[model samples]
Target: MTTTLPEAPPAEPGLKAGLKNRHLSMIAIGGVIGAGLFVGSGSGIATAGPGILISYALVGVLVVLVMRMLGEMAAANPTSGSFSAYADRALGRWAGFTIGWLYWFFWVVVLAVEATAGAKILAGWIPAVPQWGWALIVMVVLTASNLVSVSSYGEFEFWFAGIKVVAIAAFIVIGGLAIFGLLPGSDHPASGFSNLTAHGGFLPNGPGAILTGVLMVVFSFMGSEIVTLAAGESADPQGAVTKATNSVIWRIAVFYLGSILIVVSLLRWDDPAILKDGSYVAALSSIGIPHAAQIMNAIVLTSVLSCLNSGLYTASRMAFSLGRRSDAPAAFGRTTDRGVPRSAILASVVFGFVAVAFNYLWPDTVFQFLLNSSGAIALFVWLVICFSQLKMRRIIEREAPEKLVVRMWLYPYLTWATVALITFVLAYMLTDTADGGGRDQVVLSTLVAVGVVVVAVVRQRLGRGAAHDAVTSSKA
Candidate 1:
């Protein structure tokens, strides 16, 4: 006689599938393009010169591999918690708790970062408003949009992302034409493919600078995984994940590598204005575009707002997921009548507001430290995704082969290679000279990661102890 098994508890209701296909498409595109690509890339160009293309290529490939691994897992079990949920299944509660909280922390800080970045531009346009006030206004508007409903958030993101996509594509096409002396008003007779090596050779700063460029630009790629998280809320998660995964290659090749190739070719990589004004603006100016700086500033502002909007959405969803798992306050798990995670969004916005305050009060001290402490978390998150995929693939194969809608290219081999490459980048980051920002980022980020690890370990142990005690009490 077989013993009857106890029925499992019903799963808690989660975020509504309000995100549409167009929303996912734009999110996938916009997620990969951030303000860093517009503004921060100038530093990388200065550091690596023309070799920055190689740097972007390396990091892009790394992201693609990581995303492939992530897609394999997410397609199998799409959820808003994303890799955090996979870590729970593949590693343990400790891994899940640590990575989830760490990721949430990263984005909350990013909300502050993006808000400040956008505020600077807004304040530039209208000096009547203080920078902090602009930051406050931007944060309040986006938070209200998110709180209203997930669809509202998606609608905002869709249009914001669409503008970015069109802007970048247009830039690439016009710049490419200018490089070949085809654009009508582009006055640069010297512009051509030779600009790549004509200056001081392609690797002007030497080959080592490529790795330095990697360290500088890798963080720009941080938001690409936002697609996987957003997919869980889409109408068809598996399909969305698969489409996003397949599109990663072309998106990186075209949007990043293609655009950068045009920029470097049209203007000398060593142009002083590239660093002073920005790479995109300098490149546009080289093509004789009127008001290039103003145009790029507008694009950068759009990107900053886009990043801020997505950051709030991602952080709140992670919090909501944690709540459902009992890893956070239960209030975070509750949804509004319209399926909005009101408490979760507000909780995320609270930290964001505090961060904004810290920015105003301690812009150079505590806020700077907070920025550094979370700097390397993108790499850490990607590393966790790699490891989770390693174990998750096997579990998926054994337990639910039919659910494997997306598959990693080389299985464990390429997966292991991706892990090795990421480790190398991290190790390189640690070895960066003290004068540069790399070493500081690694050290501060490590400290923050360690603190989170300690919390996760303690929480896991206490949870296990409680479970054991409950079992004992039931036996009694």
Candidate 2:
């Protein structure tokens, strides 16, 4: 009798490979440029002085390394689970289960946070609507966008990213001219890099401030890796990963670090405007731009909405992937005929709604706790990606080198260096104050990291037990 191989399993629902190259490319562009850089960087600059540029550059380099690792693995084996699936294949089941849940948790928390922030701005524009009502409206709109199709999410992001790109480019051009004393009515007289050193000097706070600044800057880069996750669903996964990984770095540096350079160069490090307003627009207003705050508010509102939309989509898809992998309840794996994971989307959105309620009811207690706990997971995810890529590269080289389209530079060396640098950042976090305040975000973050490690270990054992049982039963 002839032996025949079994057929492959059917693809999971709401998990179709429909995203195109353009979607992946734009998603990569949009994911890196979050509202945080626009709204949150002012405080960082205020705290660290002109040296904050170093902070951004340090974090920017780290992001490039991490994204490269992710691209290397994602190009090899594209999947919606992206890093989680790579962790499973390259490391172990526990790695996959832990990281997947952690990522899903991270995004779900982000969904609520972004929605609330976006709603606050929307309410300002349309005061007739209550803040909570605006939150509900934002959630409903993005959820509808996601439920329609992945392409819809892509289209939304393309425009959202386009607006941001155009805005940032204009800001850079105008701001650069002002910094160089070229613009009309420019009073600052070129400043000539003196602001960076004139105050307390570049390292006024010392080299240690850079570490403290990392706590803020690192989080700004959190969403950049989302592109690799979304690319798993693209028509040409390898191609998408290649383009995104190659181009995203310069975009991030120019848009983020470059814009910050302009801001700092135009104003003193200790300007009252930086502290009172806490945004680029505020900084611009301090520099004498009319309608600055309103312009910034509008830009930030768009950024918030963009983040909320992406957050919902990321969380649901992660949940859907987890369910398909048997790490989550099977129900979440089910997709609608339209290839949308309706149940998973609903489940994530419900949690987001609860978070919004929590924010409203106990703003101080609940929101603070949520922010602290989820603070360190982004690093955890990056560390896992590094390790996963480390293992995956060797395998790909041995088994299917031809499939390795996008390879990490200085393989194994730079890869390991990235790992060491991440370890150093975590260690540094333990000593550094959160936001330059006495409060210790490091301790809270460390606890979360330890908890995730414990969970990963336990899950690995459980997966092994199941595998062993299956083997024994087959033998019997």
Candidate 3:
């Protein structure tokens, strides 16, 4: 029996299958381990105490479910636009245009965030260069790498993600050993798994704090879907998507939950420096690792650079997808000889540079505004994915049952459960306005999302009118 998968709209004709399986695998592994895990976990731990693990678990489950849904779709009909393209097929052009632009907006803003983060670390090491100089240097170097070829970007990310994976794995292993009192040079008698329960009984701040911690760590999981996007450029899109999807369980368990467990166990939840220097660094230092700060600094830099690289790749690809669909300027759909979307890349980079400028001129105000505005976009994209998959599953089953190789568990039940969970999280985010200052992020992101919705509707309406006029002219 021949199996017919749901067909993706044809590509705009320049992308090549230059990415290898190894590159795709490493991207799937490393995409989820962002600088947020190293740096933001510090804040989450401070907020949720040992209960931060619950926060991680909650968000990890959400991410795993979302990725499964995304994998089912991407594997069925892989495209560079990823969920954006899927949204187009499953829902409507309006859904695709809005979500795609929203996602592009998210990553381009993240490019600035990661660039500035990398710059701070570089400037700390080399005081000779100003911070802005370092930012420019980092951005330009990464931009050049991406512009060269898809393989060049892959190679750079391969090493960048390798460092992060190894670092986190080593931290988990060494810290676990230290927790069990097996590692040498352990001066602190207080370190053990007991640290998890000792400091105010694990749920020190109460279970509700877990939700707060969810808000903290959920965004860290944003890049996990990058693999699905990159799978489009791989030699075997369906295979790559399936492999990455299947491995999501271990990746979340080991990278996020395992590492956080080690951190909380190796040091007291109340460790002051964990908030000051970051949880990973504090864990390393607690284990008597000399130059632990510098080592973790290097790892954070690697994470940041990897994020910047992926951010550029993702934003440009989204733009390119939009252009190909005629939602964006047609030039973005055109690719260079190297199969790179130069115009799309440049356009995204332009916004990134503008963000960098905002960071420089108003780090506290305008830049923070941009940060808050795009803060909730990950949740938005996830929400869109959930809805798209719900409709897409039926379409695919009717159009191509063979592509059901990667199916979401429990069908519509779990699917609806996932949707409810995401909606609850968004509603929870809205109520987080009291004294925590999350209101800005929630409100601004909502406004931006609403604005995008309006634009999408207008665009769709205009498109319909244009089609109507063209058909009438032909008849006349």
Candidate 4:
């Protein structure tokens, strides 16, 4: 009796249940370890000193709560549409239409970013091939993986995420050993707990720097919620979601906070080596790890490829969901005999290809606009998830409480608190006007969100009018 629309996938040509439990497990663990962690965390360290750990912690908690709300809804009624479909039922057509496109917009832009990042690394190793050519090659390869079947995508992710998991775990263990002076070759003067506060105190730049660090690190957590979208294709979506939600804490704690804690402990946050070499590399090198930069670069490239693969898969599924709901072209709704939404995949990647071109041809002007415009979307998606759950919880409890295997702790109170926290983060981003591009991101993303909302509203009204006319004609 829930208000959610029934997704009769078997009754129609629909997505296959292709993701295995192993694939979902790896994704849950490794999704938190993005290329950004390797490629971007140094900037946060420079901005907030050792206090960047606090920034990661705050954002980690935020992601856990958002995933909890998302898990509850998805467990009750699994669908590839994920939050967008829930928004439709709990809020309205307009909410689903708007957020779906926005989320899709986010990942496609991500595809370009990840593709370029991976290509740069590839070109470094194989200097004969230009970066642009490498980008094209990776994009095509990953797109093909997605187009083959969901299982192919899952298999590719399983290994990609696996490599990331191993790299981060190894880094943490090696770095932690060096911090306590247990690492045999690590006689670096900086290795000790004192580095946390002894150098310049933990809050070296003052406590306000934590907020700046949040802006720097917040987007790095963008891919955390991807597991929920992926759960829909698993053998048991509700179970997959439940397990992923329960484990999010340790995943973020170990991979993000634990590794970063080691980095700060192993070396001072203000180390010139950190700013010159990346955080992970700097930490490893301080501990006498040879070829640290090269090792980190390989790990980062793997992370980038993993992100690109998942970005395509996530975006296409969202587009397919939108098409199924009539918020997009029906062609996006069509699937192959293999249950792949081929059109949806192509559409998403085509845009990604164009965005990649923009990065090369017009990076300064057009590509920057695209990047900033999609910047705040992760917050927007989390906000919508929070709102959707507030309504969804009531509907599920009143109708099918039995399906409420996963519940948000403290119900509406925590939900609202999460809402306020997300709003505060957004407000923080809006006000922080400096080199971080916070203000530009908020404004440009808002402009894009407003445009999407207008289209959703007009589309909803027009559909309603058409339905009314059809009913009148039948009556006559």
User: How many clashes does the backbone of model 4 have?
Assistant: 0
Which 10-residue window in model 2 sums to the lowest lDDT? 3-12
lDDT of prediction 3 = 0.90
lDDT (tens digit, per residue) of candidate 3 on 39-62? 899889988998999999989899
lDDT of 4 at 297: 88
Regions of candidate 4 where Cα sits further than 4 Å from its true position: 1-13
TM-score of 3: 0.97
Please give each candidate's TM-score: 0.96, 0.92, 0.97, 0.97
Across 1-118, the per-residue lDDT of candidate 1 in tens digits comes to 9733222112448678999999999999889998899998889998899999999999999999999999999888888889888887778777788898989999999999999999
Clashing pairs in 2: 14-339
- Candidate 4: lDDT of 423? 95
In candidate 3, the residue pairs with backbone N, CA or C atoms under 3 Å apart (3 or more residues apart, or in different chains) clash, namely none
Tell me how candidate 2 scores on lDDT. Answer: 0.81
Once model 3 is optimally superposed onto the true structure by TM-score, how far is the C-alpha of residue 289 displaced, in angstroms?
A: 0.6
Compute the lDDT of residue 441 as modeled in candidate 2.
Answer: 50
| Total clashing pairs for each candidate | 0, 1, 0, 0
lDDT of 4 at 108: 97
Worst 10 residues of 1 by lDDT: 3-12
